[model samples]
Target: MHISEGVLSPPVLITGAAITLVGTWIGLKNTKAQQVPLMAVLTSTFFVASLIHVPLGPSSVHLVLNGLVGILLGFGAFPSILIALLLQALFFQFGGIIVLGANTANMALPAVIVYLLFKKLCISEKRRNRIIGGFLSGSISIILSGTMVALCLFFTGSNFNHAAKTVLIAHVPIMIIEGIITALVVDFIFRVKPEMLLGTEH
Candidate 1:
């Protein structure tokens, strides 16, 4: 979800910027030379996926293949998503510059969470477990990101309560669609390129 500029308070803005700076640094540090190209590809995927967004209240709804990015890149999702968001803001003004950090944190933090929670299951020996993990990773990451967006609005002001609820409710359908999409992609990767997923590279 892209939170518009001038919506969040100053404190929230600072907090988000801090989180993104540290996260992006760590992500860059963790990234290997060989993985740079893959990182670039995933960054573009995120950039394109989010370009087609439907406005929902103050924020917007769109496909965020963050689960795929996270499970594939781990901490690398931070830089990958950060770059995508930066480009979107620079070119399309999707989220604006001031609120860039908040938007990135809103979207990319869930990516890191999914990587930690579902990476092992996604890289599991059993096909069924991998599918389940993929589905959950995709679905839960959306839910988590949506909720974070709602909270940001709510924290900004009580007037956004309605918009916050709408944002969360709107994400339910996206979560399912993304879950199915991610499940299929993860299954294919397992068969054709299992090493592409996190924790399975070794």
Candidate 2:
């Protein structure tokens, strides 16, 4: 769901950049020292996950796992996504530098929201609820991010009907896979490294 440069108007790009910068700064400032290693690992995962493409119709998409990252890293998801996207741009040029703000906002904001939701669910003190929360968060995050992307395309004056249909259709199966993967991963982490999850104080 990477937006290439020159696809959006200059005004939209500038506004997105400003918002991204401010959000990223706040995320960085809020991150705790103990969360650094987990953030690093999640960021690496985000970077590597982009390389695994799944074919859908006439197009292909990659797993982002932003929901899982957000659940684990909380507000730290912003910086993790930003770093991962920067790496992707520098190494593979998956997204243009000019569109970095839009891309980051689209992907990372949903992650933050999902993280908050997951945190609340986990507060129930039940393993099943935590797992379900993670699962729902993962699924919801994909939808939110995907919808934002569609909105971006629409606002940027792309063929909204075509773009929305393409994105929605392509993302359906991918979202299911993402949710399952995220749930499994979250369960595994809870068993072996629960501290990695945000608000899980060991």
Candidate 3:
């Protein structure tokens, strides 16, 4: 679901860049020294997860684990996504530098939104609720990201039919896998390192 450079208009790309910069700044401001190690690990996990692609019809989908990142990192999701995407672009060529802002914003915004929704679930104190919230957050993150990508394509005057269909269909299986994985990971973290999540003031 990575949007390569030259696919979007300059105006759209500039807007995305501006927004991503602001988001990154906010995320950096919220990041704490103690969370650096966890952020590094989670960012690495996000990067590696993208490599495990599942073929779906004419397209391929990959697990993002963005929801789990959001749950664990809170507002720090912005920088986590920015760093992960940058690494992917530089090392894997998953996306281009010119389109980094749009791609990062597309993926990261959903994670941030999922974090907000999960926060509202009032599951901060309950184990089962946290697991369920993590699953739901992960599932919704893919859906939101896919939809945003479709909209971006449409706004850029691309033929939305094929792109939309491909994204929607390809994401279904990945979404399910992400939800299950996120739940399991969240549960594990809750058992072993609940403080990582609970420590987030947001």
Query: Candidate 1 lDDT, tens digit per residue, 44-95?
Result: 9778887667555577667788888888888888888888988988898788
Worst 10 residues of 1 by lDDT: 193-202
lDDT of 2 by residue, 1-202 (tens): 8888888777778777886788788888988788678678878988888788867667776778989878877777888998999988898888888899988988889998987777677434577886788778778889888887877777777667688668766666778778877777787777776666535564
**Candidate 1 deviates by what RMSD?**
3.4
RMSD of each: 3.4, 2.6, 3.0
The positional error of residue 59 in candidate 1, measured at the CA in angstroms, is: 17
Candidate 2 segments exceeding 4 Å error: 53-61, 122-124, 198-202
Ranking by lDDT: 1, 3, 2
**Global CA lDDT computed for model 1:** 0.86
Looking at model 2, residue 201 earns an lDDT score of: 66
lDDT of each: 0.86, 0.79, 0.80
Alpha-carbon runs more than 4 Å astray in model 3: 53-61, 120-123, 200-202
Query: Residue 65 error for model 3, in Å?
Result: 0.6
